[model samples]
Target: MTQTRRAIVLLSGGLDSATCLAIARNMGFESYALSVAYGQRHAAELTASKRVAEALGAREHRLAMVNLGQFGGSALTDPTIAIPEDGGDGGIPVTYVPARNTVMLSIALGWAEVLGAQDIFVGVNAVDYSGYPDCRPEYIQAFEAMANLATKAGVEGARMTIHAPLIKLSKAEIIALGTRLGVDYGMTVTCYQADDQGRACGRCEACRLRRAGFQAAGLDDPTPYQIPER
Candidate 1:
């Protein structure tokens, strides 16, 4: 019998992340889901992450609590800054958490080394995404290179690959793909300001993009939003 390879998936409990997890499973990897409670304004997605991990059949799910809120530059981490309803006016929006992806991937990399897994999956997209500098292909590539150089396993000649499966995919494409994979989108939360119960605000940038994705995919969005579309 062939041994199943293990993979560490960075599950953010969002649409994209959930899809990434599904993709990893479809590829026959024994997935270990990792979520971070990184001092965001709400824990709604963290709650959703648990549901996603169970539904996706992850071998193990772990949460690392890090207080990124103490740094508090982005609206997600700082309560003082309001989440933009208009999606901002281009450039890197205020929603960009400084070094968030780097920090998260660093954590995932450490876990991967310990687990002896060379693959790490993250759902970072360049298309139909918030303007976060860290979500770019260049950033992902740089991180992959850094991971290979920084890890002891890499020093021992084990190659590490960071997988950003959704990097080039449009939101509509992602939704359609995840739908085919039997992912229940209702269990995921993409709202930047979701309520404690995980109900989306529907006006935030994340909600707008998600709503448009479902529309473009010609599928009904299963998200429960606090505010209905007019």
Candidate 2:
């Protein structure tokens, strides 16, 4: 009998993470989804994450909260910082939360150690990046190295792999992959400043990317973009 490979997937309820989670499942890993409530502007994604996890047959779906709002530098956690409408250009955007991915991955690594899961999957991408430093491939590699050194599993010579399946995939390609895996577009959320009722602002960088990806893929996004009449 083939042994079941266990993977800890970081699910964010956004298109990328949803696609990554599906990819992990399709590769025959028993997925254990981990989501963090890091005081981002869009906490609605967590609810979406729950739906996606159950739909994708994740063995476990856990939502962990951390008070990153206390140390705010990004638009997500700070009410003072406005969500950029143009998506910004070059370097890092104002949306870049310092060490956001690192912090999240640290929690994931700790959970992975407890679960004895060597494989950890994240949805970070560089091809269609948000100009965040942590989204770069080198950062992921460096983090993986640090992870190996920081954990007992690595000290004992365990083979630990950090999987970033969507790291190189373009936004359109991510949409395509998720579509192939039957990921429901409606079950995901990508708006940075969704309305009180959880409707997308359709102007934030996240919403812009999502809309563009769906348009680029020629796939009808079921989610409401709520494009305000201009």
TM-score of predicted model 1?
0.97
lDDT for model 2 comes to 0.88
lDDT of 1 by residue, 1-230 (tens): 98788899999899999999999999999999999999988689999999999999999999998898999899999999999999578888888889889899999999999999999999999999987888999999999999989999998998999999999999999999999999999999999999999999988889999999999999999999796659
Q: Write the per-residue lDDT of candidate 2 for residues 146-201, one digit (tens) a residue.
A: 98898899989886889998888889999998999999988788888876456788
TM-score of each: 0.97, 0.95
Error of 1 at 10 (Å): 0.4
**Over 4 Å off in model 1, which ranges?**
227-230
Residue pairs that clash (backbone atoms under 3 angstroms), model 2:
none
RMSD to true structure for each model, in Å: 1.5, 1.5
Which residue pairs clash in candidate 1? none
Error of 1 at 31 (Å): 0.3
